[model samples]
Target chain A: MSLLSLRDQLRSGSVTPSGLLDDLAGKIVSRDPEIGAYLSHDLAAAKAEAASVDLSLPLGGIPIAIKDNMNVLGQPCTCGSKFLSENYTSPYDATVIRKLRAAGAIPFGRLNMDEFAMGSATENSALQITRNPHDLDRIPGGSSGGSAAAVASGTAFAALGSDTGGSIRQPASHCGIVGLKPSYGRVSRFGLVAFASSLDQIGPMTQTVEDAALLLGAIAGYDPQDSTSLDRPVPDYLATLNDGVKGLKIGLPKEYFGDGIDPGVRELVMAAANKLAAAGAELVEISLPHTEYAVATYYVIAPAEASSNLSRFDGIRYGHRAANPADLLDLYRRSREEGFGPEVKRRIILGTYVLSSGYHDAYYTKAQKVRTLIRRDFETAFETVDAVLSPVAPSTARKLGESAHDPLREYLSDIFTLAANLAGNCAISVPCGKVGQLPVGVQILGPHFGEAKLLQIAKAVEG
Target chain B: MSKPHIDVRYVANLARLELNEAEVAEFQGQLDAILGYVETISLLDVSGIEPTAYPSPVFDRMRDDEPHESLPLAAVLQNAPDQAQNQIRVPKVVADA
Candidate 1:
């Protein structure tokens, strides 16, 4: 059932949290072997947790899947890398997980992802690549692929996902669901395993925009533990879901519709815009002139920071370590060698090279400067329109091995979604339509802290 | 920009990966292509703009230094491949020196 529909049933006592948990367990048991959405499940603890939930809360026992990168206490937080396969158990629930639990939501399991949230496709996962439920042969976008697939496949009412450059939205789009990457500071990252720490933010993925709003409301707030979390007042995302999109000016960036975007995906997104126009919203042709620079800038900035964040995985304190090393250096090398996947290793090298002494000023420093111009491009566009509309990916989900042979093709998958992230603005991807039976996503991007408006506009289009 | 000819062994060593020669050759081509696209970032004119680091302007919201409850030793070690006295165990590391 859609999370919103499930919420109605929950409020009326037709489905208990325990019942939802049972249903989720059954779904996982039946479908997960093929989809490989989950890395770990704690049914006994989940049931015990669900049994004690206070049903008066808005979430009221809704089943939620958490991305494996976020700590859920007593569960393994592998971050989809073999290096972390056996070394860590979250000492305590992440701030978001605690909030979900308090809201009477059941945290059913931890989902798979790109190792250390590095790759754009889930194929880099050391566990298993999560397949799109819409078509098993196609990839369920990543690194939040498992979360999106689980939600899209009805394994949970809604799932929590972390976005560092379109990890949440792209996969959600590919799976024919709704995914939100909130304003950078909107959601706390207290217990999220760091992956390009500056770019990571946790958000929700669900079947409908309204469900995304409901999930957002439950997990967003100020957290003293996360230095980047905003101290600003949290809005009632659900309360504003019905705000009509009448008179809302939506900007369509010409750069996003250019040659690389598939014609079919473009048509579907344009149709979504037309539907919004029919519902009384106005559309304006806008230009984010530096849109072409986003992929370039994102690669530099994300990797530079990732290099710094991943330094903690040394064989010293926590995580996997190699056995019977000849020396300390060998231990460090072998442990890391044994632990990280090909993509993770690739990023660490690229990141390290960029941040190293001689190249730092040339690559990392220069990329940061470009990031500002990219952000300004959005600021200028938002001034002319209430929200920006575009396709979430350049095309529909490619078949499982289609882009794997070429890593650049894989990185290009986030071309459309990265700009919203680089600007630190809130954006959501909703399934606009199908292109040749494959789902396509239309994105709604707004100014910083504009999640409520974005969700409102998304809901309008959802109808 | 002309693509750099990536040395598979060098790249793998830098990345701390123990790849066989076949894996190295395969990754050499993949890394070269990815780097080729990433090189496009250098073409942008970011002349005077300040680097956009964190998404929001707010910073330094750290928690107090007071200790919170720690996980039980057993729970922490439940998934460890090797452990001793509540700490994870790893191979020695002196050889690189």
Candidate 2:
């Protein structure tokens, strides 16, 4: 059942919350083996949460899937890596999970993701490979691949996914769902395992725009725990969501529509833009000249932060210790080498080189300066245009193993989406159309704290 | 302009990760390509622009200095790979006599 229909049914007493849990449990047993969407789940716990839920709450009895990176008290937060799986279990709940529980939502399952939310496809998971629901042969884009696949496969009502560089949006595009990457600092990152502290934002992945709005409304607010979390108040995302895009000027940055974009994907995204224009939104051509620099800048910055963040897993205080090590340094080296995958190791080396003493000025500092330029490009464009529209990814979901051999090609795939993270703005992907058997995603970007306008534009494009 | 040649072994040491001969060779080639691509940033003049370490406009957030419950020792050490007497244990950094 759809999330809305389930909510309606539960409220009207036509379908009990236990009935919903039973149905979802059955669906998981049948569909999960094929899709590999969940890393861990407990049906009994879900049923218990369902039984005690207060019906008066906004999200009463709703089952929400959590990405493995977020700590949810007593659950295994493996982060799809063997290293974390070896020793770690979350000792406390993430701020978002607490919010969900307060709103009467059952935090049901831990969804699969790229190991430590690193890869462009779910194939990077050391634990298991998550296949796209639409076509099992193809990938569900990552690092939020399993979250999107779970929602697409009807096993999850809604799921949380983190976006560093299009992890949420690209996967949602691939799986034909709605995914939002709220403005940087819009959501607390307290219990989330940091990938790139500056760029990562946790957002909702759901089957519909309204569900995305509902989930976002529940989680987004000021939290003292996260230093980066915004102090500003969160507006009712559902309130202005239905407000049409009449008279709103949506910009199509010339950089995003150029060569390398699949003709089919471009055609579908352009169709979406045209539909929004037809619904009274004025389409304007805008230039974000620094768009091309986004990927290069992100590669430097994200890894630099990740190197610092991931250094915590040193086999000392917590996580995967090497047995009978000769010395402390040897223990750290061997444990991490055994724990992290190739993609992760590659980024760490690159990050370490960039941040190392002699080269710091040329790489890390220079990239940060260029990042400022990228942010300015968006700020300059948003002056005349209320929101920006672009293709979420260059193409639809590619076949599994296609990106495995070539890492740079995978990084290039995130070209369109990385700038939003660099700029610290709100962006969302909505299923606009399809290319062949694959789904296409149209991205709507708004100024910082512009989620109301962003979701409204997404709703405007959404059928 | 000449492309940068990464010393993969040196970088691996810096990252505190142990890599064998095959891994070093593989990383050297991949890092060269990635760094070559990232070299584009050097072409632009960013002398006047300030670096954005954190994307948000907000800075130096201050909170009330009130005592709050801390994570219990058991909870903090729950994920420890090695534990004894409520403390995490690690290999000795000092050489044994």
Once superposed on the true structure, which residue ranges of model 1 sit more than 4 Å away at CA? Answer: B1-20, B64-97
Q: lDDT of all the models against the reference? A: 0.83, 0.91
Candidate 2 wrongly placed segments (more than 4 Å): none
What TM-score against the true fold does each predicted structure earn?
Answer: 0.94, 0.98
Q: Native contacts retained by model 1, as a fraction? A: 0.72
The alpha-carbon root-mean-square deviation between model 1 and the true structure, to one decimal in Å, is 2.4
Measured on C-alpha atoms, candidate 1 has an lDDT of 0.83
Query: Which digits, one per residue and each the tens of the lDDT, describe model 1 over residues A315-426?
Result: 6766777887776677767788788877777777777767766768777888888888888999889888999999999888888888766777777778888887788999
Ten contiguous residues with the weakest lDDT in model 2 chain A: A1-10
